[model samples]
Target chain A: MAFEINGKTYETDEEGYLANLSDWNTDVAGRMATEDDCDLSENHWEVIKFLRDYYEEYQIAPAVRVLTKAIGKRLGKDKGNSKYLYELFPYGPAKQACKYAGLPKPTGCV
Target chain B: MKQIDWSSLVINESGKAVKKFMYVNRHAPHGTIYPLEGLEVVLIGAAFDQDVSMAFIGDGVFQLNKGQDTADSGMKNVALTYGALGDYEVTKLYVEQESLDERGLELNDLMNLTWEDEEENWAEKPSIQVVSRAQLSDLLEQQDVILNF
Candidate 1:
């Protein structure tokens, strides 16, 4: 599937994750969140940015447990746990945030 | 409703038994999927918390060569994933010296992989070790299970 923003087209998978990670931009992410009936906030952006940086370094989207631990290390305890992360992305942190971050679904996610 | 200790069903009275599991990789990383698939299996197996290790001989030695850029080739650069193995606690990566010598490669040609020693104040320690073929044979003999790819 594909979506257009101001005459620029972006390809996405059947599940709505961006087909080409490089095609992602703020507009693309915002458009995706809107489709899910979720508004993008500073808190959500923090997790999205973290996921992007992680995929850039690791070449794989991390599982939820790994993401939680890494977030605790880089962000803070208050923002690290599953409860806090779930509050930001209701569909599940790794699955939803990674999609918004233009990453493939995590390797271990069913 | 009662809560059962599920781990008790798997572990005997001797406590959890950790086996020496070795994955021997002898294939190139890009040409086929053996090495990549093997690495994924190794990562999954690590969850068992066994005494896991990997040995690289033959073409497998090339899997560790540095400066792997796959952007132009349109292939995923899984060489970078080797760096993450340390986090899985599969830290012992034994490379055969004879294999490297045959390919005219030196120890420096490989990536510098390391694991942190939580017991030693989280000190970084090298994970890759170059061993003679004979030494590798000895290691193979000691493993409770050996998987080859």
Candidate 2:
């Protein structure tokens, strides 16, 4: 699948994950979110930025359980819980947030 | 059907059986997929909350080499992923000293893998232990299951 913005085409997998992680930018993330009928909010950006930084360090998209714990440690208890994350990305925190973050579907994620 | 306490079966609560799972990585990190596949199994197994450890021997020792630049090679550099093993509770990593010596590698040649001890005020501790061939053999014998890649 592909999406176009400003005359450039962004390729994605069948599941809508970016084909090339390097192709991702804030604009790409914003466009992807818009496709899902979701708006770009500060809360959503926080999780997306966290996932990008995490993938940079670990070279893998963390599972939801791991993401939650790490977010709790870094962000705070209020923003780290599943409820808050789920509210931000309703499809599933790790799976949906990681797609917008331009990472491959998280390892071990169904 | 009755509700099963699955966590009780795998978790090491007192009186519950917890077996030692040793993943022996014996291949290079990039040439073949064995090392990556083995690491994935180790991570999944860690969720069971059993006694888990890993032994890096032969070409496997190269998996922990520091500053791996795979940008031009087209292969993903997964060396950084090893750093997260600590968070998965798979901390015990044994590196065969004989293997390192054969390759002219030193302890500093490998990545500094560590885990935080939540019980001890979150103190950081090293996870890799360099051991001799004999020592690794003895450790291998103690495992309930030894998975070799």
The per-model DockQ list reads 0.49, 0.58
Q: Which DockQ-derived CAPRI band holds candidate 2?
A: medium
What does chain B score (TM) in every candidate? Answer: 0.90, 0.90
Worst 10 residues of 1 chain B by lDDT: B5-14
Tell me the spans in candidate 1 whose CA falls farther than 4 Å from its real position: B1-19, B118-121
Residue-by-residue lDDT tens digits, candidate 1, B1-149: 99875652444245886678999999988999999899878876766667899999999999999999999999988998888776667799999999999999999999999986656865789999999999999999989899998
Q: Which 10 successive residues of model 1 chain A have the least lDDT summed?
A: A65-74
**Per-residue accuracy of model 2 over B17-43 as CA lDDT, tens digit each:** 888889999998888999889988877
- At residue A4, what lDDT does model 1 achieve? 97
The fraction of correct interface contacts reproduced by each prediction comes to 0.28, 0.40
What TM-score would you give candidate 2 relative to the actual structure? 0.87
**Model 2 superposed RMSD (Cα):** 4.5
Query: How far is A72's C-alpha from truth in model 1 (Å)?
Result: 2.1
The CAPRI quality class of candidate 1 comes to acceptable
Q: Clash totals for all models, in order? A: 0, 0
